[model samples]
Target: MAKIAFILLCHKDPDAIIKQAQSLTAVGDYMSIHFDARANPEHYQKIRDALKDNDHVTFAAKRIKCGWGEWSLVQATLNAVEAAVDAFPRATHFYMLSGDCMAIKSAEYAHELLDRRECDYIESFDYFDSDWIKTGWKEERLIYRHWFNERTQKRRFYWMFEAQKRLGITRDIPEDIEVMIGSQWWCLRRRTIEWILDFVKRRKDVMRFFRTTWIPDETFFQTIVRHLVPAHEIESRTLTFLMFSDYGMPVTFYNDHYDLLLSQDFLFARKISPDATELRRRLGVLYSSDGQRFQISNEGRSLYKFLTEKGRIGRRFASRFWEKESSLGRERELLIIVCKKWHVAKRLLERIRQMTNIPCIEYLFNEDSCPLPDLGGIQSTMGKRHRHRRALMRMLFDYYDTDRLIVCMDPANLDLLEDFGRDRSLTRILEIECHFSDEYLIGHAMRVGLAGDRTPPETIQRLLPTVRNDMTHESDRIRDANFENFLRVREVDPTDVSARAISEFLTVPQDKAHEILSHDHLYAD
Candidate 1:
């Protein structure tokens, strides 16, 4: 029987922490908890009172004021680990976790797995060899003393950094140590942790050197464990499932991620939202169940990857709207169709696809309409609706492998018009202004329901300014107009699929063509 000792660094949410402790210690496991000194005293008291009767649970005697990217976090963790060791002398392995971390597997499974493997589970990498640091100073983070906190004192931190650079001031890392960096979370064998703690006590020079380092918690244990443990005795990956965005922010898990969580074989997952009570309760049941070993599902992993990538692309695309160079996509020509009714736009989209064999998007921004699923279900970020729509448009333009794309967009979506209007080099707009027709009014009524009473005309009326000034309007008001000529005037290729589609579209009898194009039903491709 392996006795695992869990050390949790917690700040807020007493109830969630209480539930987590109860679940882990139910099967004779030992736990040590450290509450941030900066948090309210009531939180600590509440947790203590709730777990008062559990002999398996203990609280660290020393609470430290912790801040992001500060040495206090490492110090606090050390205090908790020391407390756990003294209290639970028989603990076979030590696992470091956070308040937001949840056990995704049974305790028995973890104990048995750790017992069989009998190796330190931590990620230790040579920082200089990897591109792990996304946007910040890399080697500077270690060589230069970070006197100011990076997050709270942004200006001062940068200023001091520059001043030190100009002055050529640098600090020497403690001798006989290779600087290593990785995730702050790790699970280590009892002897490995005991060795590390003993080393810290014996070598005050190494401790002093790291005290001034930036985000020492990420490097302290990782570097030390690598220095002492043999190569084969350590695993270069963590047992905890953690993910970060392209911008280096932690990806948080919510209640909706239960299926994704169950598909992985990780022992635990961190940064689970504190308000996710249902997720916590369900995971608690799974953790306590007498279930078989968890299996890794390739389909589930791929789905998770796709979702995360979709979100990343959406965010990346949305962030570029304010910049002068906003267009980011495959280097290809883009044709966008703007119409009041989605059904009409979708019809045009299908026709274009038929002529060109190019990828056509149907109602890219229509919440009710489906976009391409393989592109990983582009989720809209609320409140920034216009920005979200524009981001998706640009991301799709970037995502498609073909040299051209036909997208159906609503005319009321003026944000994209204004956006594409600024960049006409590779983008062409084939807008159909039919807001005044009876068919348009009927489609508007059906789409908007009661809200369509006054808003349809009002919406079109508001669009008049941008349409007249920013866009080329060719309406029924134009006499003897040619569809192919309209596209040619906008610099469409004479032999392009768009031109071919329009030329064929014009060959149909006028009334029959109007009836085919004016129908209110959406085109499903």
Candidate 2:
């Protein structure tokens, strides 16, 4: 006998909200919705009238004008939770959801999943240890009392924050409770909900303390549940699939994401686009249907990782050419292979690929098409070559999910080469072709015309000295006996490679190096 009571906080779109309520409602379950006090009266009335016939649906006893980062949001949710508890006395669990949230699976599946698990599912984490907050004051959110609405009254909010900082004003969290933070949505056991409400009733001072705290909705219940419930009884993950963008805004699901949404194992998803009528309709139908259990695909999680793991450099570099000119902060090792000829560059890349398992891209800055198969149909026009180069860089660092990137750069782009060399902030290794003999220069220059433009012997000779000088400032030079041995590129002579030299350059663990170099390609001639 497992039952769930869904408490939803809605502000707009009466039709959508009614559809969601109908999807979530079942014989043994219940639904309670709290309409924002600021929303139009007509919208609220329309929703109330639409769902009035459903025996399991009830509206909150009172409406609250909710604001982001304010206590009113929590109050509204609490009102809805109270109403749901009163109406559904047999409910064994209570789940908090938003107006935009829609079930991706049948309500029966969710009940069965929760029925077997005694532990509560919520995203509770330590306020200090967890790197959860992307921006804004972390400790200040708990220590400072915020009276102004941060979303609506931005000026007053910041001014009050600054005044408090100047006056050295602070507030103390109740010592009896451990402060925790998490997503506002959760699925808690009925007993847990009762305990939280009871604690709130008895601890009026704690409620008063949180009344002026910033974004208490994300913290109030999180802190209470973690404090009252045993750690082993709580699971620090949400039943709902929630993700935020780099700017800390929730990513919205659209019509194109219908198949992707169906592939996730999560019971529900939120912040869906209002205009996504097809997606809404499909999910609504699925939620009410008792279809066969879907297999866990984890496609959503993979997409999530793809979007979020493109670190500082990858994200910035990917958008640099198309968006704006900005400085890129290097986060990982970069390997630059500078060659005057594409044939030489290709040979070196093939040799490097055979020796080490690290990924290498050929002719990344070439004027023509790049050889990469993943870059679909993006013609490399002369004007868009720089954009393609940056896109390849992003693919190496982010999509390939590698710690090191090896790229062949054209020596003709002296300005770009000089920038890479002179930027002392970057941790990079530049391997330049040092076989500057007359015969080698003539042979390579003749083949260079096939790749792009022909390079005269004197031009390379003159540029070599300048390239060396520009690169010698902050780096050390190590020359090998063989012309093809690896040169630390400064004013150094020819470059070449050996297994030991390549292994040392990579600096990977001994076992990892063995694992990488043991491939059949490395052993082949």
Local lDDT at 472 for model 1: 33
Task: Give per-residue CA lDDT, model 1, range 22-130, as digits (tens).
Answer: 9999888889999988676888999999999999998888999776787988999999999998999999999999887898888878878888886899989887787
Candidate maximizing TM-score: 1
The reply for model 1, stretches above 4 Å from the true place, is 298-301, 308-525
lDDT accuracy of residue 230 in candidate 1? 96
321-398 per-residue lDDT for model 2 (tens digits): 223333222334566665544565565566556555456777756646655433333333645556444433443354
**Local lDDT at 68 for model 1:** 71
> Which 10-residue span in candidate 1 carries the lowest summed lDDT?
485-494
Looking at candidate 2, what is the lDDT of residue 408?
Answer: 72
- What CA RMSD would candidate 1 show? 19.8
Please estimate how well model 1 matches the true structure, expressed as its whole-model Cα lDDT: 0.68
Q: Number of the top candidate by lDDT?
A: 1
